[model samples]
Target chain A: MPEMVNLKINDISVSVEAGSTILDAAKKANIKIPTLCHHEDLCIAGNCRVCVVEQKGVNALKASCATPAEENMEIFTNTNKVREARKTIIGLLLSEHNNDCLHCYKNGNCELQSMAKDYLVDSDKYISILKNYEIDRSSPSIIKDDSKCIRCQRCVRTCAELQDVNALAVSGKGSEMKISTFMEKPMDYVVCTNCGQCVTHCPTGALVEKNYIDEVWDVLNDPSKHVVVQTAPAVRVGLGEAVGLDAGKSYTGKMVTALKMLGFDAVFDTNFSADLTILEEGTELLTRLKDKIENKKDVALPQFTSCSPGWIKYIEHEFPDILDYLSTCKSPQQMLGPLAKTYYAKSMGIDPKDMVVVSIMPCTAKKFEANRPEMYSSGYKDVDYVITTREFGRMIQQAGIDFETLKDSECDSILGKHTGAGVIFGATGGVMEAALRTAYEIITGREVPFSNLEVTPVRGLEGVKEATIKIEGCKAEWKFLENVELKVAVAHGLSNARPLAAQVQNGESPYHFIEIMACPGGCIAGGGQPMPVNNNIRKKRTEAIYNEDESLQLRKSHENPEVKRIYEDFLEKPLGHKSHELLHTTYTKRKKY
Target chain B: MTEINIVKDAVKKHGRKRESLMPVLQEIVKQENYLSEERLMEIAKEFDLSSAEVYGVATFYSFLPVKPMGENVIKVCQTIVCDMKGKEAVLDAIKDKLNIVPGQTSADGKFSLMAVNCIGQCSNAPAMLVNDKPYINLTYENVVKIIDEYQS
Candidate 1:
């Protein structure tokens, strides 16, 4: 066991580990310490001095977040000096901040606004010295507003640590210090992946997703337009947090009800297309393997999954030379988009032009993904608008709908049906596990060796996970005796994916298939999920995702009735001609920096 | 060597590690007088770092400017001791001679004026650096004479 350090926090004896901070000790003693720069997901940034606490016999107040709790130390969390220091620091921060809360995008959910209210910070205490910075709206996914930034560096740390994409950096020093892109370039001109991890971790209104709520509202009000909506697999588990329900609770049914009440003509599920992704992507993987191992052709081994738009953009920028290794499958959101404008419109007898496809996604990058020129495969724009789960919650609030009291409802027919494997696509290693479940069965003509098809080895919050499955008893017309061990790797967050990408780039990889997600935990803790996401919330959302998968009757993707019917009636088969035009897309190389 | 090759040579002289970032940047600034975005990007590519990270470090030090500078650059100390010692008058004199204020290069491309933090010349209260050479205990005449000598 680790050595424990004993301390007295606010006269309550608290025992914590030796390396624990005084903030940790205060948490143990149930003494709440308000902090602005300390985030559970980032390293201790003591720049924001709001968490200063009084230590006995010490003239200078200690920053509880940066100071470790020593044995026999006496710390007071709510002392007068501490309170005065916090209020003064907050007031100073406000003097530089543009306190236009009424006109701000993050007015209601901003952490700095909450702290100012908690401390009753007098904004007029100091003269206003706010720098007028031009708001950067070059990227369709996120906006960078500098006037309201408090320079807490949480977004900087998040971009550097979690994503390993240092598109943001602390430029200058002292009062002139600001978070900026390279040479102050607009975000679109730089190497930013539009992941929006910076947006989620921002304490102020500095970084926010570009809002399409008003456009969505306009579409809903237009009688001439038949607006159809699709919800991603992660949105079902994550929307609960935005709608004031507890985290980890699946709100799939109620979310559909809310979309219907909001005047959507049809509410579909992205999970259905997620099932379709497995078929096409799985078939592509098998084809590549056959070419490499059986036909003796030079092929890119270890095909990478392409469901995440952020990961797609990252590889395009960082590893442009290895674009051939990425699977040609479009993300489930993009797949559903074209299908909605074409197949769904035809089946429902609605004109494709009049049908506006909106995706309620757990990602901000989906907004950029939908706007890509290649997404216009249906002769019209595939997905019209992409809104985050948070934006959808705001829409529900705007419509004055009681989310909790809404009766649970089922999704509309054609593109709404889903399976357990599709629902599990929200989690990190879910796509790998789902593919293995179907591939193993297809190869051996038996159930996957895993109990109940859990595939426990690939599941969880580990940054990178590797699993090997030995193929046995292969069914073939003229069999070459084979006992091949198929190796697969799963990685979430760009930092973990970097090493794997390097290995692939150098032709040193030892896996047949690799799964990569840009966000930390997966789509469940995506960039556009409810705010204040950390490892704790990520775990709860992952558990809810697994629970959702178990609750469904159809656990395998191929077993999805809608998927089978799509192949039989329309697409014909996975990787077929129809699937190529709609379900698959290509990637382009970007500037290396 | 060209500015691009100079940055590459600096990176080669120092290693690719993070500690070498400073020496590489300082070497470029020493030869070029200021860092261009292109040279910064070249250093970033060679060091395997993001361009924003290199830009951030370059901007953090007032000495390492990201914009082009004139042939002769003048840095006036703007710390408390120099401020109390009539540093503003010294800055005003430089502005009058160069037809430029702090953070601006002259129209003739002869001089650039900047009010930077202390260069540890506090004992000689009001001090300024003209191309790495410090001039201390200055007045309006001394500042004008200093500028006149560099004008040719």
Candidate 2:
């Protein structure tokens, strides 16, 4: 339906759609042009001139990533002049970059390092002009090292365009310019949501997740300590990409096997607590609806899901007025932490003091969430040593374990069981689907009217999705009314969430429940997932999540055996006293700065 | 009016648009001599932008400083023309006179010294500006006397 543009690169004819970049046309002809600041998930940033190519009859080289391909245009990708300019640019960037690769966290995986090796730049040709900047390790989630930055502005663009949380900006100008928070304050002191998208997008070692590998290794080695690890739903799908496996593959059995081999006394699943979250959150939603409809009392409708720590912190800072609208449920990671120290430890006859709870998550914000002052409800820190999925993969490599050769293993009992509803929490609209699967049955005594228990409307990578279900044939405890429409909405990424939140703040929202994830594709494409995340990678992870859901025997959270047992033996009921003390929390307002 | 009122008034004069940020910041610098953290935050709220964004624009220009300054800011040109014409000696003289190096304020809160790029007075080499009033073709004695007159 659209017009096409024909171009010749390296003397090979290629045709691409009109308005496509030279980079796109080159890709169609199988010509690889390397770039540093060009990200598939972000807008075009032509600051890095690494993708320059020669256009015939043009005096100057054009940045291929930013220049649109034209009809019958002749472009040379690997000409001698282009290569020399790229090499010179690489050398110039390295002149200011801290080249202490041995001490850098992103040594082997850094994009700039790979480019430098490919171009074979002379590192010593230019004198070292690296500025002396103290690495800011203030936040528990990420480290900001300005000495290694290349000023590509990819992180700056990601913070502004993708998340709409401009916590980082290019301050100063020219040679003195650097990315900084307000007034160059420490990261934790600012209004950072601690999402770590900047860490994933940074091409160098400028930003990285703070490592707790040594601390985790210590606990595993201590004889008196009992180490237990929990893997989040997204980790199973994302960990594969880090360990040389392709995306869209579930590494659950192998991941559990690797954790067991890494000396964890018990390996559990965060999905078990995710199922628990459905019960508590669903009950709270029903209670609010009852208060508003039956009791004629004012209650915050369109209750927001609180499973994402980054979203929790974002709302606390940017939308403090809507804190009452947020569900009081702690994230599944936090829910499992206190329960592990109390219920699991007591049941397993282990002392709470000896049990060290470690979480393998797809989020960096979980580290910040675990470090909050109020997370000590379990008497000890609820969760200790939160490591990202990438860090876990590194631990497997550090232990000299061949991940592909490991046999599949099942998780430990009590906290290891889960359901399809819980596993789908990795994707954007997953929690809404999971909650509807349970809440509809509770209200109408019937399963959600969907095929194979898959809610199709709320699925995929759309930024915002809305659905409505007409409650019909309800069981009458005392019927307020029947055939009421239950409207729900789902949103991912904080940029999409800000408008929905404003609607709620203005008392003009039309939905009864809202699900928001701070990351683009929810936890599967989280900030702490493998680097170089793109639409293709996010799609692969999302499909793998649904594939995992289809492969499970139990499709509903209420049907999870472990969840039923927990409610019967310990929790007693949803939103009960025991559950409230352990599984829910309050939020604090933060400065907008 | 309070400092926050000055920021609000500037925003009112320049209007709350993205392109108006520069003029608002320049107006603030004209009145307060420097942009403060509180004033930046106030402007951010008025414009519905983030504090980092406002601060980024404020700090990008050397003429609009984010840090507090003394009674008078003395910007010594460090461009090629001035550097070639014995700007270093004049800078050292100012440092000795005020007992402070570049990027620092004097103890008496009278002068803050900074090495800036070209002030566009290349014909008058070894130039300096105290509060936008240029003293061109300077020497160590000229800079010393200038600091003495401003110190009082």
Model 1's CAPRI class is: high
The per-model lDDT (C-alpha) reads 0.92, 0.92
Q: What is the lDDT of residue A256 in candidate 1?
A: 92
Which residue runs of candidate 2 sit more than 4 Å off their true CA positions? none
Model 2, span A1-593: residue lDDT tens: 89999989999999999999999999999999999989988899898999999999998999999999999999999999999999999999999999999889998999999999999998579998989999999999999999999999999898998789999999988889999899899999988898988988999999999989999999999999999999999999999888878898898899999999999999999999999999999999999988888999999998999999999999999999889999999999999999999999999999999999999999999999999887888888999989999999999999999998899999998899999999999999999999999998998888999988889989988889999998888879526537789999999988889989999989999999999999998999898899779889999999999999999989899999999999999999999999989999999988785
True contacts kept of each: 0.84, 0.79
In candidate 2, position A323 carries an lDDT of 97
What clash count goes with each model?
Answer: 0, 0
* Residue pairs clashing, model 1: none
TM-score of each candidate structure, all chains considered together:
0.99, 0.98
